[model samples]
Target chain A: MTPDIIYSGAGMVVFAMGLYGVIASAHILRKLVAINIMGIGVFMLLIATAHHDTLIDPVPHAMVLTGIVVAVAGTALCLWLAVVIRGLEHDAASHPSQ
Target chain B: MSPMLFVDGLLASGAIALALLSLNAREVFTSIVLFVCLGLLATLIWARLGAWDVAIAEAAIGAGLTGALLLAARHRLREPTSRDDTPAARRPHVS
Candidate 1:
């Protein structure tokens, strides 16, 4: 098999695994991790497919760069939400008599 | 398949396995660590596929920053003995 074909196949498999994890996992953090994994797989596939062009497409690379940044920002927000939820729980636990 | 293809396959499989393990592991800490490893593996794969920028981003943002956030959140949420009790039950009823 060609290198691109192999990479594409592998990317698909990883994507499937990530999808399965997202569907089956109960914890919110695990779901977030699975979503990130799937994002990586999609990024890999886009980069690999762009290699087919003679000059290599810059468009997909640019898009993926934007996606990476957005992904990080989204993760940060999710983490903040998790922290907030935990804090609420902590407050509720500590002031039970109040 | 070429040697490059073989290597890509191996790295890709490793990445998938790590992701699965991370999501499926019972312990949250172990899952977070494994998720970081998966991000590293994905970085290597991106490098192999000639996406150096993506590789750097994945290593730095996906793995490093995310891992730190997860660790911090885990610490904030740690309540070993309170695992059995629901958060709602721990709250005071403000009558």
Candidate 2:
């Protein structure tokens, strides 16, 4: 099989696995990890498609770069939200009243 | 298969394997570490597929930045055994 075909198939499988994690996992942090996994799978497929026998496509590479940045930023935001939420939970549990 | 093809296959399978392991790990710390390893393998995969730009970005941002963030978040979100009642915490309630 061609390199493109191999990676493309792998990418799909990875994406599906991530999707399963997002659905099945209970923790919000785990869900974020799964979401990042899904992004990686998509990036892999894009990179695979960008490569031909003897040629490389710059557009997809750029797209993947942007995607990587966005994914990290999104992860940070999610983590922040999770921390804030858990902090509130701890507060409520400890205080038992406003 | 050519050596290059075999190498490509190896990297592809490794990436998938790492992903599975990370997702299934019982501990969040273990999961984060495995996911970082997967990102590194993914960087190599991008390089193999001729995406040098994406490879660098994945290594630096995807693997490095994201792993650090997850670790910090995990620390912050850890189960609060500290929430157990010390006298100070109970003082307000008793008063």
Q: What is the C-alpha lDDT of each candidate?
A: 0.76, 0.88
Please give the DockQ score of every candidate, comma-separated: 0.38, 0.55
- Which pairs of residues collide in candidate 2? none
Cα lDDT of model 2 by residue, A41-95, tens digit = 9999999999998778899888889989989999999999987888788888878
Distance from true location, Cα of B78 in model 1, Å:
1.3
TM-score of 2: 0.90
Candidate with top TM-score is 2
Candidate 1, which segments miss by more than 4 Å at Cα?
A: A92-98, B79-95
lDDT of 1 by residue, A1-98 (tens): 26567667767877888899889888777777888878877887887787763566768878888888898789778877976777677778878985
lDDT of 1 at B28: 80
Cα RMSD to native, each candidate? 7.0, 6.0
Error of 1 at B40 (Å): 1.2
Query: Model 2: residues >4 Å from true position, as ranges?
Result: B79-95
Which candidate comes out best when scored by lDDT? Answer: 2
